[model samples]
Target: METGAEVSGQAGLAPYPVVEEVSSLLNRPADEIDASVSLGERADFSTRVSELNAKSAAGDPAAFYGQQLLLSRIYGLVTQLPEGPTAEGSIVVQEVLRQLEQATIAAEDGMLESGILDAAPAEPTAFLSWLKKLAKEHRVYKHPYYREFIRDQATADDLRHYVIQESVVDGRFDDLLAMMQVGTSGAAKMEIAENFWDEMGNGDPSQVHTHLFNQIYEVFDISPDELERSLTANALLSGNLAVLLCRYRNLYAEAVGFLGMTEWLAPDRFVQVVHAWDRLGLPDIGIVYHKLHITVDSRHAAGWFHNVVVPAAESERMRRAIARGTLWRLNSSARYLDERMPELASHR
Candidate 1:
């Protein structure tokens, strides 16, 4: 449970020369933020990224806003190494990530002010009811990506591109689940264990979820390097959000809400993807991943709701955190799915 301030060499997190005043960019007017921050083409973020991380820890929305790619990639580093940088570096890292999480959640909460989230229930069973209602009516389902994929209108290039975008988070799911179980116990732990076991392919390496997901990319010939390049900032934000919530124990309730939505979301989404695959004549092997998740994730979602989300909601503090986590997952995912549309169309 110890963390270190040092990043592993393979993590590609070498120190960039310190830059001053970079956090100011986050405060620029909304339209100007895009132009000023250089979301594309201007790659030199330097050590200002660290400064941003520090500021994010202080509850600055702009700070969380600017450093998602850095955050996401830092998490990728954690998964790649034999052990996470959780000693001294993790102490330093967790605080920064933890605060950044609050800032991000606060910002999203600000946006959803007076929205449907206001109706979340205080009691356990009622909260689950609220969560289900939110998931069912989530606007992301109406996403053009799903519509096209379900209707068989997506091209081979489109499906390939979609999966690559998905690799941003789905690829590291098992590791995330492991990080999630660190401080959990009793019923919650059991629920996560069940899901983790399924992810582990029920002790069969050949059937591991990550391996199954990779098979789709393997069929598409996306090298790890290619997968990295294919992901957009929005896509990385979703992944970053996952790592942020899971890496810190204070954020545990949020992690529960986040993963709850994820499990709940996947089955429906993957089912649509499968429809696209069969309709477009893609190989059965690539579609195999979706086919399996359509069943597994459905079961996982149900269990996660009952065992995890419900019990945790007993505390008002937990109720609030879980609400933030659920909305965070929903909103971050919507950002990725919505943005990828134009980005993918450009490739067609």
Candidate 2:
């Protein structure tokens, strides 16, 4: 399969001023732009940068990022689009698909790290600009499944809780740290905690996650790259881990027993994800939580048990709120997968 790059590696890409236009349009600092370039690629990048500058002077502001990101997404869809019935076009389609896959992943990753995913609880001020960019792209180009995902999965409503939480952390980081404490030996008030591990524990939660991912992919017609770009999933898992840790740190300071005792007993839920991926032959795209948590979560969970739970949770009400939130997050994440899976599968 000949990708766009492969088809026009020498000639087509030569005139593309994406580098200059992107840097100037985004108003990115030279340092940031330089950070993205490889050591040996400076010369080529310099040439592209000059072209981008020239184009920027002539093109519409909304068109550049919108078109580029849209194109990036199309590059992904090109890979995932089913080869039509004709055999003659299959090779070309296949090549295009590969390019799309690479481009989508790169663009999505770039968006994620750039606080693009952090745009939830979106301000209309910020979102209007962003929407125009996306709208222009959709009008001028196709981005396969990512366009729909942005429209459907990432509505203003979906961002409410995340935005609230972001505000809490941003405004109260020092206060939260002050609330940390030691743990004690007392058991949890709810009987649910006694058997909670078993009830919620599906042996390996990664298996469940993998199943959910597969269900989502087949049902939603989501491409592998788009699935990888689902930063909402990343935030959910991160929020849970932080809450768990905050509680633990409070508990540990109070001399309450920490969860480290039980940490080893519970199954390695994330590791099982690697197993599931291998078994299913799924790409590593959707395994963001699995990859991040397999190691970092252990320390985080332990810290939470030792510090936040023991010290701050002075009443059953406080404990209840924390536990309820944990339960709600789990339930919501699961339900989202269940509901979306069937809908997505229909697209297949």
Best by lDDT: 1
lDDT of 2 at 328: 30
Worst 10 residues of 1 by lDDT: 1-10
Give all TM-scores, in the order shown.
0.76, 0.25
Per-model RMSD to reference: 10.2, 19.2
lDDT of 1 by residue, 1-348 (tens): 112232221132322222112322322333443444443313334334445656655655344434554455445445675342222233333333444455555556665647555567888898888877776677664565686644467778888888887886788789889998997999999989989899999999999989989998878898877776556556667777788788779889989999888888888788788888888887888777789988988999889988998888898888888887888888777766766666654553
lDDT of 2 at 189: 23
Off by over 4 Å in 2: 1-268, 280-292, 340-348
Candidate 2 lDDT at 261 equals 20
lDDT of each: 0.69, 0.33
Q: After best superposition, candidate 1 residue 313: deviation in angstroms?
A: 1.4
Of candidate 2, the 10-residue stretch with the lowest lDDT total is: 1-10
